[model samples]
Target chain A: MTPLAAPKALDSFFLEARCKILDLAAILDRINRGQGAGAVDNDPRLDKIRKALEVLHDQSGGRAERIQQIFSLDYDPGWDKPKPRY
Target chain B: MYYIDPHIHMISRVTDDYHRMAYAGCVAITEPAFWAGFDRGSVDGFRDYFRHLTEVEPKRAAQFNIRHYSWLCINAKEAENVELSRGVIQMIPEFLNKPNVLGIGEIGLNKNTKNEATVFQEHVDLAMKYHELILIHTPHLEDKYKGTRMIIDMLKQDRRLKPERVLIDHVEEHTVRHALDNGFWCAMTLYPTTKCTPQRAVDIIEMVGTDCIMANSAGDWGKSDPLAVPEMIQEMKRRGHADSVIRKVVYDNPLAFFRQCARWQEWPAETEVEKAKRKPAKAHA
Candidate 1:
């Protein structure tokens, strides 16, 4: 389905979006400011977060759903089968 | 514009939150037993928690004219302790007949472990044996999609559990269609962080038509808002959605889901005098 028009959508949600973006920036800054840069350098979750950030710049819609998928587990076809936790 | 928060943990919230919710036009709420912020060591802990849900919280909500209902379970986080989970599950039936008890839920997976799955099936077995409705909590963030997929699979395996009578909660844009397309009812939780915001929840509603789906605050002992559903109402209003459409997601849909429970009562059951007083008004209109 098509998204609501930008002006109408922005009128209601622009501030919320701005605040969230600021929060994300501050979070990244905090991570950068932390002493242990190497700790997160190879962290897969951080990699995923970076990939999700790249998703935000796409012109086409569905970014939200795509980013959610980026954070979500890939669909495991055999997920119902019980597996041991490491 | 009155609405029902189909899933919130009222036991974790202050009485003032209930008052604020009432003022914001929340007419009713359903609280599912969940992680108490820390795991309890014994089934007795859960037993006492159940009493608080079925007894204490309902009384608290009544003061503000908001109807309170609850579900019972040892949450998925605690379900890893299979022995304790079983003990809690066995004791759950004692509360099933209580006036405000809804069904077995917020019962799914946290880590989607083997032990968690075992506990989940046992809870499902208990629910099916009692013919009670089910409410499921899909795991959060990274584990959500897989956990939700597994939850739906497990439920489908049980021929006795009807899809429509179950609700898979905390579904986001990715998982919403899975729950709905599988014939189960689903709820999107509106959270200030880490879940759908009011704007995103409205976006989901825009993407997926309002049918067999609803939204809730899922307010609990976290950095969450009890008025999140009201904020969703505001968001929908700003987008120029019809009030009827908003009402369906927030009001009628939840009532329809809860009405399936045999124990669910008609709230504010009108007195005969009040019924008579209302009939004349209806006739004039």
Candidate 2:
């Protein structure tokens, strides 16, 4: 019989959290770069990118399932909104 | 290479304190006014104490090449008598703007009484009014945690007070979270018999990290040490804390704190200090 996988150590969750936070940071950078550089969004590909990012940044509680879930996890919807003119 | 005691009571201390602190490589000290040996009876008591703290202790520390900083406030224990303490609080402005007066501090609840709570709120108001940093003195024994929370609530009422500038002193195991979660700087007092031991302080530093954690020798009427700050630093060093971490906790943090004092260096000695007045006030009682 195949041996079961080794049990996780206490730091596994913390390490996972650190990786997730870093991943979020990288995605945010990419989106900001796209906006600042005035990247064209005519392709259907850009729609998929924006949708994915919207979900990931706004998550509430239970763990996300797939990379899509990471994108779909809405934390602060207004976080990426443009500033209002006074 | 050097350490700072962020919350010592040098006015209630002795001459040997200067010698011992110098031996510890204590380059600077911050003395927050607390009970002041006995309950100060009048506003003049505060005036005299402030003069001594600003004018006297600096002279004392200079002999040992130690810089002294003073925090003027009505202590928590004294808060039990709100009427008398209010009289004292009114006089804080006289010296708060004086030289080396780092902040309005060492003020919080004692005995968890209403009188203590009221005085605590009063201190918060005064600190917020002046945009001064606060130095909180938590109650000893059972009231430590409760008093810390009470002080935090009062602080929250005023959005003007920033957590970075406020220092909560004399925290034990149970009192740390309230200080940290509130975003205030955390200070541990190493009193040999009662508050915290040097070894326990090491354990705390290991758990909390050194960003805003500082250790002090809060030696008052209790059995304590003038070298407790250095002893705690030594313990952390022997336990393998980095030199940078030691500097942040002991030197950088206190120096930055004193620098933020509203009028810390403005009030030089009003009284012409007689020659060679660098003797610690062991005999002030």
Best candidate, TM-score: 1
Clashing pairs in 1: none
Measured against the true chain A, the candidates' chain A TM-scores are 0.78, 0.32
Candidate 2: regions farther than 4 A off: A1-86, B264-285
Residue-level lDDT for B28 in candidate 1:
91
TM-score of 1: 0.90
User: Distance from true position, residue B181, model 1, in Å?
Assistant: 0.6
- DockQ metric, candidate 1: 0.38
TM-scores for all predictions? 0.90, 0.69
Clashes of 2: 17
lDDT score, candidate 2, position A49: 61
Span of ten consecutive residues with least summed lDDT in model 2 chain B: B267-276
| Model 2 chain A worst lDDT window (10 residues) | A77-86
Best by DockQ: 1
